[model samples]
Target: MPKADSKFISCKPSKHGSTLEGLAPSTVLKHSLLILFCKDPSTEEPSVSGAETGIFDASRSFHSQRSLIEQQTKDSLQVEKELHLAKSQLLSKKIEDLRREECRCLLLKRRGTELACQILASKSEIDALEARHQAAECEYRQREIEELEEKEKTRDEFYNLRMSELEEFKESIRRFLLDNRDKVQKLQDSVSENTCDLLAMQLVLCNVMPMQLKSTLNLLQGSDGYMDNGRIAAAETKKSELLAEKEKLEKYLISSDHLRTLLQKKLHKMLISQDKKKTKALTKDQVEK
Candidate 1:
């Protein structure tokens, strides 16, 4: 028994053998004893001894125990392998999920950065547009102011020129009125003298004509009366000539008065126009202010 145990313990399967190669030392010893019992009894010595029979029975018991242990070991190894495989697959899935999350985060960060840059660019463009609008508005206002100033200057120059011309016209009218006044005064004096002379001549004619007529009638009593008639006709002719001269002087006085009235009206119109122009200039100045 010691020799058999030694031989079985010394036997070992190769590293690249079957499942029995990985068995524990005690299991390997059981398998080796079972193999020895399976050999034909004829191949052994034909002597029956009580000690040998006892050894055979003990070997049989060891064989049954070895088979049960081997079956249990196989089932345990199968269960452990399945558990390891499941753990490895779960770990691989977790790694893949983590990689995907990291990629998603990187993509989100890049998109956020791009959006920020775009927003900044848009803001700069808006600022540039506002600046341009302000500049254009200022330029337009300046141009409008310059145009108004130019128009005002032109109007002032025109007003000054017109005023100068009006002054000169006023001076000429004054001189004409002064000269006509002296002429009118002389004509009035002449007319008065003529009227007084005519009145004196008419009085003398009235007194002498009747006296002469009466004397002619007395002196030439039975004569033809032709000489008396002729003398009367001559007196009448002299009276008609004096009346014609008086009518001519009256006509002259009427024409002079009409001319003076017309001159006064023209001077009044000129003064009114000047006042209106001054008022217009004042209104424009207020508006500009």
Candidate 2:
């Protein structure tokens, strides 16, 4: 087998030399076959068998290497496809996240716009309410002023009427006092005249009769003595009537004084009440101002 392999290598030295210089596999295979044919017919069998065996081994090695390269290419393509799919999925996820963020931002902007509009509306409503309140206050103040003026006018009218009535009462009281004084003076003059008349009668009686026998003579008197007794009784009755009239006049004067004091007290109270009302009104006006 070794001698046959040596002979086969010697037979194809030039062809093998060309094959080693990077020739195509078909060219190398053609060169090998030509060398095999050109061998002596007596040595052909063993050389042909050795060349065929080497050709078969070379063909098997080429087929195995081709299959290994195809499998490596398929595995690389699969890996590239997987990486591309992963990248696509990652890009899609990023796009989805961005879309969600945009939606959230838009929602926030819309909410902010709605809130701004609500604030403006609230401000306008507050301004309108304030205007209405101011107007109501003005109307209330006007009504209060009118009412106060009416009350003051009524009070003045009432005070004037009361003053007129009080003046009339004072005038009537003065006239009553003046009339009582005249009556009292007249009564005094009458009492004095009656006293003088009584004294004259007493003197005449003393001259006409002894003091011890005066009572006895008056008791046993005839017609002239009886007349003198009647005159004395009439004078005493007149004096008693005058004293009763004087007492009645004194009572009337005292009642009139009490009535005047009560009127004065009532007037003073009314004045105090009016002053209080005035002070209250002034204070109220100041507060309103």
Best by TM-score: 1
- Positional deviation of 184 in candidate 2, in angstroms? 3.6
- Could you tell me every candidate's TM-score relative to the true structure? 0.57, 0.47
Whole-structure CA lDDT of model 1: 0.66
The TM-score between candidate 2 and the true structure equals 0.47
List of clashing residue pairs for candidate 2: none
Task: Residues 116-176, candidate 2: write the lDDT tens digits.
Answer: 9999999999999999999999999999999999998897787677668766756765675
Local distance difference test, candidate 2: 0.64
Off by over 4 Å in 1: 1-77, 155-224, 227-240, 275-289
List all candidate RMSDs to the true structure. Answer: 8.7, 11.3
Clashing pairs in 1: none
TM-score of predicted structure 1: 0.57
